[model samples]
Target: MATMKDVAQLAGVSTATVSRALMNPEKVSSSTRKRVEDAVLEAGYSPNSLARNLRRMNLKPL
Candidate 1:
C-alpha cells in the first residue's frame, strides 16, 4: 500500500502539506491542493483512519 510519505514524495511537498490538502483543502493553495490530489491517485495512497484515531487517543495499535 502506498503511504503518505510516498504521496508527499510524488507531489514534491511535505507530508504536512499533503495532510492539509486532504483534511482541509481551504488551508492550502488551489495549485498545491491539485498537486497533492494528483499525487494521491498516482501513488494510490490511502489514509489509515484507525491508526489516526489511535494516535489521537494516545493508544497503540496491536
Candidate 2:
C-alpha cells in the first residue's frame, strides 16, 4: 500500500500540503487540491484510519 509520502512525492508537494489538501480543502488552492487528488489515485494511497485513530488516542495496537 502506498503511503502519504508516496502521494506527496508523486504530487510534487510536501506531505503537510497533501494532508491539508485532503483534510482542509479550503486551505489549499484548487490546483493544489486537484494535484493531490490525482496523485492519490495514481499512487493508490489509502490512509490507515485505524492507525490514525490510535495515534489520536495515544494508544498502541496489540
Considering every candidate listed, which one attains the maximal TM-score? 1
Query: Looking at candidate 2, what is the lDDT of residue 30?
Result: 99
Compute the lDDT for candidate 2: 0.96
Look at candidate 2 and give me any clashing residue pairs: none
lDDT of each: 0.95, 0.96
Q: What shift in Å separates residue 43 of candidate 1 from its native position after superposition?
A: 0.7
- lDDT at residue 18 of model 1 (Cα atoms): 97
Q: Provide the TM-score for each candidate, comma-separated.
A: 0.88, 0.87
Candidate 2, residue 29: lDDT: 97
TM-score of 2: 0.87
For each predicted model, how many residue pairs clash, with residues at least 3 apart or on different chains?
Answer: 0, 0
lDDT of 2 at 10: 97
